[model samples]
Target chain A: MTGPTRPAEAVITGAGLAVAGYAGIADLLGPVPADRDGDPLAGLSRRLGRHKDRATRLALLAGGRALADAGRPADDTPVDTGPEAFDRPGGRTGVVASSNYGNLDTVCGTVDAIDAHTYTGASPMLLPSTASNVVASWIAITYGMRGANLTLCNGATSGLDAVHWACHLVRAGRVDSVLVAGVEPGNDAVTGLAGAPAFDGAAAIVVESARVAAGRGAPVRARVGRYARRADLRDAVAAVAPGPVDLWCEPEDGAAEPPVPARHRLEVGAQLGRRSGALGVLQVAAAVAWFGRHPRSRALATCGRGGEASADAAAALVLAAPEDRS
Target chain B: MPGGIAGRGALASTGRTAEDMFAALCAGRSGVDTPRAFDLTRYRTRHAFEIDDRPPGGGDVPMRATGWLLDAIGAALADAELAPDLGDVPVLIGTTLRELRSAELAWRQHTDFDTDRLHFGHALRERFGATTTYTVTNACAASLYVLGLGLDLIESGAAETVVVAGVDTISESTFGLLDRCYPAPPEALRPFDRHRQGMLQGEGAAAVVLRGTGDARHGLLRAVAVNCDAYHPSAPDVAGIAAAIREGQSRAGAKPSDVDLVFLHGTGTELNDQAEALAMAEVFGDTPPLATAIKCMTGHTAGASGLHSLIAGTDCIRTGAVPAITTLQRPMDEAAGLRLVRDTVSGADIDLVQVHSFGFGGLNAVALLERGR
Candidate 1:
């Protein structure tokens, strides 16, 4: 009843990010920006355009940078399918991005659409891009990726879970590589006024099976050795049942080990603008930065919020390759 | 699927009793009538599949649209034989608009909007009084998505049991929104028909009890996966639907042949039917299993369709008989090779059924439900 110890093929090869304090991994390790009293989305206020919302902008920018970082094109192109598709390391690339407030722009538009009829206002373009999934499709269409594209919306865990699932996809041989990103723009009038804390950022990583990344000569950043979901950790206690405990340790060799990094303290009062979906990006940014500094360190992203008070979730181990593996 | 509705109840236009509703559906009776739920008299089209009622607790009742939800939740608890005091069990309610009723009230009274009280997420926690609760407002697919979330919680040992609910009642805001965008013909809902105009806005509430695996008689909730097409918000990526079907089947530890039937999210809309048909064909090819939708019978109940279909499909497997599509005289040519269950097939062993629900955010959710072992 045992499958191959695949070693979690979903490893990060490259990452690209754009956010408030620092652009890319620089901001992750650098000093975080101070939260202003009245201003939210302080880092991204100047970048908003009439057409694209904050989420889409982060997606496009980060996606473009990630692809560029991986040496892929930014624009869509007509390509012949078959073995040649696999020959190109990025051909089988899929996109998985998560965001808390998908298209706040569209939500506002729907409100305007209703208001337009009420007050005889202007007719807004009720574009499908406004929906959360549009970012995924936009990536697929733009990149000509005929592989899986998914958007996970588990609030702060969206980015983390998307990366987790993206890793699974690679392990399952659904795709050779995946572009997993989490983006959130500052909330508009509705989300802003309704107490959605302003968060602005996008983080993406190029993930591939270790074998595939090795085959393509891509640099491997980390190998996610193990991932586990824990619940209700606020009490500093986990309701460890025999069965879940077994599943958690199923793939482990001998020791029943706790998977988080050493010498790490959980920080509170962390504020990101309304892009809660970018929480994964935050986690990745922090982990990658930690790796960049400490080199051999592994990190874990843990959180639980939004009504399910007792629901505790911690994506345990984020491990990087040994320094010489590069 | 995983946990059958051990106890369940529903409130629809045809009445709350299973017998009354099933009998009416069998007789090809349509519960759709004049657009009373919403004031659609201003627009050219003024028709809907509406339900007008409310739950037991008293409050400044908004339009009687979401009333069926209360009854449905209560009935589900009763069916599951669950105690009203669920204690620590989680509650996940899927809705397109939990505040539409309040919004209607506010608009009617010319009052300022209160987002906190009217938000679906907050409202669900208040209504259910659960220790843990969250709202999945992913448009039409909200119900199924919530169900999937509940399944995740159970699988991950987050909760011993979870009550998942989906509810959307007819409202002036929805009607107005649909009227402006989607144009439905003033008649019966016809899924897969070439002449299909749009979707009929129906209202209902459905709740299911999901229990963890080790529990006694915890039915097999075979497979459930929610994939955001990240396509257009309104339209599902046709290719993504195929990917979902493939992924769902793989997760269920089954093959294409294992699916005995398909309970489609057929709203009788042109875009949806075509997209679904193409997706099904792409996944299962021409020799797919028998496909049908209950929308023609129950109408597009928004968030309620997935759970409703899950209930109906489970019943079909439990009873060894697939219910016929009432009043489906003609099937689409593109839907060839797939048998349309027009006449009720008696004593067929339907071991597995796939239920699909595509929501407004281009969120595609497919759930594979196998008969309880």
Candidate 2:
């Protein structure tokens, strides 16, 4: 009880994983479907019908898993998705979803319909969902988390930045918990459309304040402390998590790591794909889930993209094993 | 972790720079005109505000929003006197349709398929060498939230300085949706008026440079808050919108008495105006803040509307003249607590400005701006 409150150390009480044609973290490594190319949204038949676009489905699946992993209900008691309709553990829960290409399939498709025929040709209903917030809105509505709904699209930094944002809000005492989702639903057709083979899949995590997690005695999957500018493993990592630290980040961001005497390695980005804003969170969630079985080791998830194209864009999320509950 | 609005630039149908745009609005120059973004011959009404300026050899490329974004960013950098090389500076851009117009061309034509959606970020990063570029598209409120995110970046030490931009180009689908959503005789756009009919479709792009207190030049931002209704996708709940407004005020530590002006989202739609009125009553109590809906001047810029409103708020704080809502000849009957600005009200000692932005599907954001003190 007598330790400095790590500005960035929030407990990752729950984690969720979902990719194209998959349901939740259970199916993450269960099996690769023989008909992988077949309809990726067959499981969502009862939940959604016509407008179940790729981005929306990915958000829902990942969000559902994250909620369940946190020991919350998959769906809130059917209530209005309004401010008065929802209740939160700490009165506020935010969802920040990151993406570079936001609902592009519907955007391009609607534009195509308009071009091929006319305004009357394209579905008016599909036009509104083109906004990137649709993903965050769908996630909040389905889960009934009503703190905030924000969507950030800044290449791969989008995912990690969303994490930083959630951390900042919780630290600021604005929200009690945040459900962060990094979803792009990557594919060849989409990557080809974007002119890069850099993205595919979705990942989510439930981040609550260290005080809240400690109060409820929820087993902390990992602790992310105050976000330092340079992920110098020494200062950025909280004192409470002092141990032999291992850095987990994508290959692109490995170039910036300081020569800290710790086990530095790459985890999810390489296998997922490459060059995506969603990698930041995917790798963070991947590392959190990785530590589920292998406790005692500290893992810091970092990712970045900068230079000739975007301004200096980079972020890092520190995760470490919790102190003994006993 | 408070931040300041260092610099700003706007490119709407009315004028380009802040001074020019404000001058046009003060001179009663409305940007509303017939549709030039697309052909609306068969629609009920085809009124919209479309920009006339084009980049050199423009329309030659599939992505037209690129040119507008570049121009706005360039202006913002110059206005803020920031260096062109944005090393370690995060860039946040907001756009509902990054380049849907380009997609329309690629779809109908076999030879011109170049509607690449992800090129906006790459193009800016390569040209400007930014830290990172972000695109936020939460419909009309995207730009405001993007600005809010910029504040988060500075507060979290992600970047000492950040550039926020909002850009949206009108296309056939946008005009079509606007035509159907508020199918009224759109000779002009009117919000908060008793006879208010619909919002005109407008294309606009704007940018602002935000920095910590050390770098803030013109004004300071007390707080920025955004939340979702979890309500219907198309309809907004008055209670939800009011809750967001109160939360933003609480975060800013500002009472209704501290606010000198309020920039209503004022989309000119009936439901939006009424909800905003009810929200004002809930927040300001008996003494409501002076309100102005500027869309009647610039029409509705959609995603870029928030930036436009922020720009107008900055002018109000600096010049001490609140631009009045022009189309409010017959104000809404329920707007008792709202001090509507019907004409140019000047010579007021304005300190704090509260701005509201709400989008479809229950996305709501409110930002509080204070004159540098």
Give the fraction of native contacts in model 2: 0.45
Error in Å for residue B175 of model 1: 4.7
Top-scoring candidate (lDDT): 2
Model 2: how far residue A20 lies from native, Å: 5.5
Give the per-residue lDDT of model 1 (tens digit) for A19-73: 6545456555545656334322333334332355556667766766676676554
C-alpha lDDT values of all predictions: 0.60, 0.69
The digit string of per-residue lDDT tens for model 2 on A1-326 reads: 11244454467788776665444443432344344454544455464534666777766766777777777656544454444553444238877888766576666666556555666566767756666567777777666666766776655456777777777667755577889888776654355455566455567888888777777766777777534322223323331243445555543435554423456565454444553656767766766765665576666665553432323344556666665222
TM-score, predicted candidate 1 vs. hidden true structure: 0.72
TM-score of 2: 0.86
lDDT tens digits, residue span B105-161, model 1: 554543455533332333333445443444445567877866766776665455677
- Each candidate's TM vs. the true structure? 0.72, 0.86
CAPRI rating of model 1: incorrect
